[model samples]
Target: MSHAPTTLQERPTPAPAVATTSLSSRTLPRWAPLGFAAVAIVLGVGLGLVAGWHSRIQWGLLSALFFVAISYTVTTAVENKRQAKDRLATSVVWVCFVLAVVPLASLTWTTLSRGAKVVDGYFLTHSMAGVLGTEPGGGVYHALVGTLEQVGIATAISAPIGLLTAVYLVEYGKGALARAVTFFVDVMTGIPSIVAGLFILSIMLMAELKPSGLMGSLALTILMIPVVVRSTEEMLKLVPNELREASLALGIPKWRTILKVVLPTAIGGITTGVMLAIARIAGETAPIMLLVFGSQLINTNPFEGAQSSLPFYIWEQYKIGSEASYDRAWGAALVLIAFVMILNLVARGIARWKAPKTGR
Candidate 1:
């Protein structure tokens, strides 16, 4: 009527399958992506020459080959193990970044090449004054001012509301309020810029307000708010729960803790989000056209009258279909890109400055 004593060997724990997964996945070479890209380019060129389809064949081959390489990396690098997830994630991220860079660099080069002639000092300070046909003269001064004023006002409107909404969602909101805010933010994130412009336009019409920089700003605000809210919300959420708990333990109010700890901790991401939001809206053509009713000359007062943003200027002059107009349009595109780049750089600087310190 006796049972044998239990032993640790009898209760042996199951070995993790995760280790097997890591070994399987991590076997792929780190330099696989570069090799794949090189192969793609070479094969694409060779195949293009063989097929006589030139551009399409080369592009098709290159894209197919490059994507294949990325797929290979992802498949091999992501199998089974959860620990290798960081590697998998980084691999995909770098792939995406490289893919994006090709087009971006091409765009920059193309714009700079074509726009260089018209992007001189005069173009920066002068409006599209008395030059026509193939003749080139004048500048995008008016467009610059218009873009700035419109986007600045839009930022003024959206940044506060978006930040507040994120703050509420992060700090105060719960139940229906939080859910509704999240739902709306998600919905707004997908709203097209053209739709925002139309919404503002419709509202302006009903209210009998004339199209101006102010209205353009409102449209941009609509387009910007969702992005800001989402980004800020994510950033705020990244703040450690321990900090909040610590503050509460110190008898600090929840709101004060968020203000002092959470916001500061996530300020870097928040500022970057704000800049990206601004950049997104600043280049919108439909909103500017619908709200500001594009002008050829400088209108200093954003509140008082019609304005012309860089996008609107591009849209306008590109239609003229003359060399002069074409050159000017390219120059405006370059300027717009430059403005966004500068803003992004500034945001990066801010993010670095405000980034939270690490260490336990």
Candidate 2:
């Protein structure tokens, strides 16, 4: 009777056991990708040899493909479909990066290896005055000088005008005039260098002016202005409106505010844009050919006589069709590349120097 009234003690339910996995089991090993890559490379080389493929590029491509496929297959088997997809994407990105870098590396190596033979102090300081194109004993002095002068003149003429135009467009532009200016700039951006050269040639012909470095500079100016304008406009647009408003609230005239606050803030980018524009025009051969009338002797006076530039020198040497001429062309090309690289480096330095400092 008492047992009937007594309640049975309830047994506590045990918590369900969690499924445990070792970290190594759930994910790929640290050395897995390297091992896969090594295996892929070995297989690629073996297959290439068996197939009698001569090009190393083919082998590399095959290796990259194998790497991606192997990574996906292994990941899928070891992990899940999602992990395999991620590994596949990663492999694809790495392959793309290598593909992009390989060409640039090859070009640089080719240039350096070939150009070093002729790029010495003597090559830098002399001019192609007396030595025949078939005989190798000349330098790039005249061409270097002409390039610097013409590019300098073009920069001088284009930079201020472009900066002002960009300023007007970004800061003071309001109506149809701004839109028209923008339209013209866009049109000019796509205008062929030869067209600009022809336009300047027409003007020179009208003025009865002979082909000279000045004429070449005018054409380069035309080509450079659009680049500078577009680049500077973008840079100025990146400036914060809040800064402008803050300056205006302090009773600063719009012009003064732009000159002091806006320009200073964006000066780094503006300088970089101007330098890039200079680099863009530096290697233009069409304008130089149409106007500068390539010369063999040094012509420091850009206003009066024909001049030789790096591009013109390269072209002239290439036309000669001699071993010496080929060497000179390669040398000139290397120099031109170095010039552009130096400009870019200078732009980066200036950008860093003039970058706005932020308070912590």
Candidate 3:
């Protein structure tokens, strides 16, 4: 037998050239294009100012150009095609920012310009009072109440059904029924507001809930449900499977798991989605026109009597043959827009405040 040496023999090691070669072969990360973006933006902005483009349109163009330049730079940088990624990214971002600002600025300018004629104290305090002819004065008090009632009722009706349906789809729904619901929700997502109005009108014709704010609420429910379901479903899906497994592992019922863990995790997003759904239907004129039958005077009884809403009032006033009516329409439109803006801001705030912190 060949005697084995007490000291073990060792194989010769290769030089570090292989490791160095491997290291050198490592390609750069794709984020490199950020450099070109910087260079393009600085270059483009200087060029824009040199040209006589001080208008909103000019700003928009410059912004777009800057975005493209930055995007190109980032792409190139990622591919190791450029060296100046940071500056390129910055320029592009600024350009995009400027572009974004222009539209909001234009919208504010246009809305104020057109709406100021109707935004007097009388416009805020007085109902569409004495809006008979050219000399203007009137407000949107009645419409405001109607809008609140209609949207409130819609939220009340839609929230339960939509949220429950989403829960079932996510937690309990199995095969065919779930697929059917998903398909229908997808279809409903794109249902035109006018179609929802028609559907409600047809139902009202059948049961004779005709031309009341209740009927308007019904139409809004149809419009709001799909949005709620879609958003809630997406939110619920974001809940980790581990949460479900852990709750079950603790011998808790599935329902409790959903209530305690899943819902709490996703509640922030759900609330924001619900608010957005409300905003979506708030401005629908067709449904209100068909169901509520807008009036100039306020009617608080959403169940029994016809009511007016800001959108419907705007529609009605704009059609009337009086300058006062037109002015009131613009003023009412501004108020409606303002309300929508506030709702969006509130939703954003709620989302931020309630969102779960991820880190320890």
TM-score of 2: 0.89
TM-score of 3: 0.75
- Rank order (by TM-score, best first): 2, 1, 3
The best candidate by lDDT is: 2
Which is better, 2 or 3, measured by lDDT? 2
Q: Per-prediction TM-score, please?
A: 0.80, 0.89, 0.75
Query: Which has the higher lDDT value, candidate number 1 or candidate number 3?
Result: 1
Over 2-96, each residue of candidate 2 has an lDDT whose tens digit, in order, gives 55577799999999987766565688887898999999999999899999998999999999999999999999999999999999999999889
Q: Which stretches of candidate 1 lie over 4 Å from their true place?
A: 1-41, 56-98, 357-360
lDDT of 3 by residue, 1-360 (tens): 899779878999977754544226544444533454455556656777788655646645665676666665554654454544654566567667866887788787777777887786767666765565355666778888889899999999999999999999999999999999999999999999899999988888888665888899999999999999999999999989998999999999998998888988998889888988998998899988788877767688998777889888888877875767776777788888888888878877877777767897
* Number of the predicted model whose TM-score against the real structure is largest: 2
Clash totals, every prediction = 1, 0, 17
Question: lDDT for model 3, on a 0 to 1 scale?
Answer: 0.81
